[model samples]
Target: MLQNTVSTRRNIGGTEFPILAAALPVVANDPVGDTYWHIRLKAATTHLSSRPGQFFQLRCPRSEAGDPFLRRPMSVYAVDTNVGEIAFLYKVTGIGTTGLSTLVPGDTLDVLGPLGVGFDINPEWDHVLVVARGVGLATMGPLARALHHNGVALTAICSYRTPEATIGLEPFELHGSVHTVYDTDGTSDIASVDSLIREEHARRSFSFAYTCGSKRIVSLLQDLSSQLGFGGEVALEQRMACGLGMCHSCVIDLRRGDTVESVRVCTRGPVFSLGDIVAPEETLSWYRSCDESAI
Candidate 1:
């Protein structure tokens, strides 16, 4: 266990809290669907305060393939602040996660943070749409719980390789309705998801469209939000050596008015304002603009 570990206080967006390096007991580690593992940890009360969209850097145990050099970042699937539990959904891919998948109920794992800013829930938002695909389905649970707690209505669009591969439906369904789209059935295509989102929005206008798991889906939401006049947010996936912002490895450009500025995904966001994001097609121009500024 990460017993009696010292926590360092860091000021983030003006709030100072201890960033814990806790060794939490693994309460459960089991597969969800055929694609993902659902791991539950018995957390300290301080650790349970993580919000939806926040992630932790879990130190994976060494396995047959050898040591994973860095901790793996996984988004919070659920957090019960009162119950002292936290959960994560992740797939066993590559060296790190393969080791993660080997964990059992009796083990203790080292973890850091409730790192980075999480999704900002607008309590006034009456209706929200969440789009997720594959393992991204795991990232939606806590967000669903939060929206449900706020009495906000929700619609979740889950895309997967097959119907049986779908994950996280229970938490989302407990909070609101869920729509599954399958690649095996061609319903996971952008065009099909676009149509589905439009039909659902028409039935009940969404105040916000939030997405993770697919960039194409994020683009569709960005376009639709503009056309439909609703707010939008998106979670981005990036490879990180350090889950903290200090590494400069996970910096991404974000638009602030006419200027584009770099921000760390591990700190400023893994969740960004969909409207404020610099489009992928404009990346070259942003680099050029940065060059011109330097010159």
Candidate 2:
């Protein structure tokens, strides 16, 4: 399978990591809580050199759900270079993820990526903040580890529909403090979350921020980034085909400073500056009525 790998270079923070398009062996695939599956794959060190916010186009195996024509774009959940492994935490939502759910140890999973841009981390920042919910937890997971590795402090505000459905606990706990909010308790409400972020920002004085999962949260953070004078990034949720930009299927209108331009989510980003996004509250997509991710 390693012999089938294809490679290309992508520059992030001035370093180039070869993009991997290979059929890697699944090392572990297991259910998480009630709704998600955590799958690990054995791959070369190069395959695991992915940064947070970057994603892969997963070729789900044929199953009862049938053969899915397009590969699913999944954000990298975790990477372990020491063990030559990479992992993804995905919900079983459609044919693609349903097939993914059937994978087991030693099975080959065709994957194309470490694709797209990743979160831009500023080395000078001493402390940072992250806000995530549901699949957003998977998107933010690797970034937390990278920040921890760099000795940067983190404060995570995690939201979930239920405690049982929550994901990405360990990385949130590493090198930082975590605040859990659940929809059942009503603490995950936008207003309450806005208040929580403001208080935390005042105390920790986070120099930068990052968020994934909810538009309301992104909207809230966008307001704060302006009011508080701290800059941040948001990892957008978009359903894409071609993971590469060739198809232009994931293109979206983006506001950058004073100019508004269309950009490709798979290329320009699944990640963007907090202030650069336009009307996140009105961003009516999972890239529309979407969020079950895995489909």
Candidate 3:
């Protein structure tokens, strides 16, 4: 049976707690290419109970004169209960992320979180596949850790624009098998990723598949899951001005039976079952036009 690590009635997605956190030392901050950063922050006791796949809205300290007015939504990379700390892995995408990279130890940040519904891992599944690209790997770390602790076998594939862009592979390797893929340099490609998923599915017959990345990749995995006769879940990446449900900006169209309805990604999920979602063609086009290096 799946251990109930979180309470269903706790309103994990609805409740938002504002917290003032102090920056801890960086775990790994590589400023080459796309600039991968892994930052840690001291958290309150309540925040320490964060589950995998949940995220936080972080307001970076103001710059000298002008700064971003809105907080950035970041995935909960990992939570260290022992130290009362939470971590986030992010790429320097815009002003918000660039500001986050500049923080030194003891810097304070306004954070609101442990929000959104997280991945629901079935305990019955003996083995599962986790597919992620770019910074999406950050969201999967905590889920992988939970699965490892539960003795569930994991096969993870992390893809990046280049080898230098990859971050936080050690934790996944420690928990289960890992496969890395990159673009342009020919280290790996979409075909290789598909091949790995096929091979793993054929060999172990994955109990489920979990993925977070570009809409293109998520769509591919969703199709693969259907073809392989296994259920899958996807964590979406969307622009959010508000981490709460009040902002309809993050709404996604979901398919329910024969009809489609809109749902808030922030409140309902950053994570959703593949079967429950309907990705618009425009989203796929946007993903194709985007620079692979851009997070």
Candidate 4:
């Protein structure tokens, strides 16, 4: 029996709150690759009610000349109601993230969230599958926790660019079984992720699959879900100029019946049903190019 949490209807998209940086951001150095950081913030109980797959639009401290005005959209990694805190896991990939990395304990940040629709957790699901790559794991963590709390069995597959780049494995293990794959090693060839999904389905089918990662991985899972007869959801990544519905900057094509409609990623999603998403040809080509370059 899945136990539903309190409704967060009042707290959904467009809610803004002031959050205090609870501690100095912690950076984990990957011996073989780039560094990843985790940041926690003191938040109100209202803010802590965020659901899995939801994200925040964080306005970090301004630059020396007060430039880079837009807030950065970050996935909610975990929410701790007990401590009244919410956290995010991110890599310093650009100027905005770099500024976030410089934050110290007690720093104040303007947080606009828990924005976007979160993953839908149904009471009927018994077995669930979660797939993520690299920092995408951050977005999947809350869903894993929610499933565990609701007594649903979980199987998580995480892919990293290198073995050393993997972080936060222990927490996922605490919730359920996990398989880690690295691209640099021969491990990638041992058994493709799709094969594992097929194996799992043969053993005991999953009721639903949730994934957040590269477009290629998401597309693969979407195809697999259709083939195996299971529902699937994906959290998409896109560039955003505004965290609200006002900006069409983060629009993606979504299939509604026979027609494809462009929808804003910030408001309508960062999360969507696999069947509803329509991948553009250019995006597919870009994903293919990335794969080719990696090979």
Candidate 5:
């Protein structure tokens, strides 16, 4: 399949391109809330080796609003290879996303994608657990489906600030077990996530845990996995300008050994082994505090 594939011509920053072409229905409005939009991009390339927790970079429809020239990064929600389409779940938090929200069907939006390392799925892992919050739900959707198709057991706990913040979970239910945890207040706390994992662990020996959205939550899962003796993986989120690895905007401090090391979230991972990452406690606590401060 790689033989027929063409290297992504749109070089946003030396990244892999899952974005084949901009789909005609350029913008799709999902009332996930006044804040979020679900978009579909036409991917002409045949091989989308994208796993869960990988992300894409998107350029909003061009306009006179004088928005940032840089593309904004987003997570890959799902990929339909037979149809040659890749989907995105994004929230309109700033000028870039606001411009994206105004686009209608047939409008053109430049996108580059399927970039970054993704979650690892092992055939030996009979049971899989997914933990995510808000828009983070988009990052893990495809993995759940892939695992289901492979006959691996799946369970998910997706959290949102309120009922309106939830979408795209129905697809998860169709494939495997799904449980929603709607936070009335937008806390995105580790306590709730910890509770969910504990509840699930009591029932069965989950082989692996997949997480996305908040770094704090990822760190928490990593800690919980260690305590429970289950392996874990995390999809990280960081503010990015170039979706590719060229820019160092998304560098993260990782533990390589006794020393803390830097890893780029764009290329090295949107996904990382929970065990391999270093400084989980301090780094994630800072990140979660910032997230709460933003709200």
Candidate 6:
């Protein structure tokens, strides 16, 4: 369990008391590649209730001018409320993450969360098919662990562009059966997301399909879920500034029956039902552009 934990309420961004904190870091280090970092936060009482895929708006302590005011959003990688700790798996993309990467073990980071909607898993569903690409595995890992602890079966299909880009698989395999797919590497027999899904379906019936990765993969899973006659959810990677509803930076167009409506990713969802999203091409493009801009 985490030490020195306490809880307090505070107002942020015109919203009264949305965050709680222990305001300290328990773990911080670079993962295998420079592309990502693993951080564990010892939270105050309020951080205990977060669900998988929900995120926090993190505030980095500044040393110079021209730093951004609004906290940057990052998904909850793992939660151990008993220990008063929350884990984060984030890549160093911009000034926020770069500052975050520089922190030592004892540094304090201001956090506002557990924000955004998370994956909704049905208790009745015994088997879950998890389709992940790149860092999406971080968003799905804790849910896989929770479901596994509850006796639900987990089958993970992790896809990467190459062997070097592959991440978060070692821990995921601990919770379930893991199949790694590399597009340009010959380490695994499966090279594509579609091929891996077909392999899983050929073996057994999966009640739920959870995806968090590329928009192309999400689109594919939506079609496959309908064909397989199962419910599914997608965790979108959007460019979010506020991690709250006010900024309007993370908007997504969703289909609500015969009509389409726009929803903010930070508030309405970072996770959405497969049937809810409309054409995500523009949103996906925006994310890529923003992510590139950060780099």
Best by TM-score: 2
Q: How many residue pairs clash in each candidate?
A: 0, 1, 0, 0, 0, 0
Backbone clash pairs for candidate 3 read none
Q: What is candidate 4's lDDT per residue for 1-295, written digit by digit as tens?
A: 1121222333234554333222222322122236687887776555687789888777766554344578888998888888777788888777777777666665666676677788988867889898887888889888988998888888888888788789766557989889888788655432477788889878888999998736666677778888888898988777787767777888777789988777888778889888886664634322233343221
Report lDDT per candidate: 0.81, 0.83, 0.75, 0.72, 0.70, 0.72
Off by over 4 Å in 2: 5-16, 280-295
**Model 5 lDDT on a 0 to 1 scale:** 0.70
User: 20, model 3: CA deviation in Å?
Assistant: 9.2
Error of 3 at 264 (Å): 0.8
Q: Tens digit of lDDT per residue, candidate 1, span 177-264?
A: 9888887878887888889989998999999988873556766888999998899887776778798776888777788999988888
58-171: candidate 5 lDDT, tens digit per residue: 777655555768888877788888777777888877778877877776666666555677777887788889877777777778888888888889888877777776776965
Ranking by lDDT: 2, 1, 3, 4, 6, 5
Deviation of model 3 at 152, angstroms: 0.9
- As a TM-score, model 3 comes out at 0.85
In candidate 6, how many Å is residue 39 off?
1.0
TM-score of 6: 0.84
Error in Å for residue 214 of model 5:
1.7
Better of 3 and 6 by TM-score: 3
The Cα error of candidate 1 at residue 43, in Å, is 0.4
Better of 1 and 6 by lDDT: 1
Model 1 bad stretches (over 4 Å) = 3-13, 284-295
Candidate 6: which pairs clash? none
Q: For candidate 3, lDDT tens digit of each residue in 1-295?
A: 0111222234544654433232333434335345777777777765677778888888865554348888899999889988777888888767888888777665665677667788888778899998887788889999999999888899998887777677878779999999888886654566677787898888888888888846666667778988988888888776788877777878777788887777888888888888876765534322244445332
lDDT of 1 at 4: 52
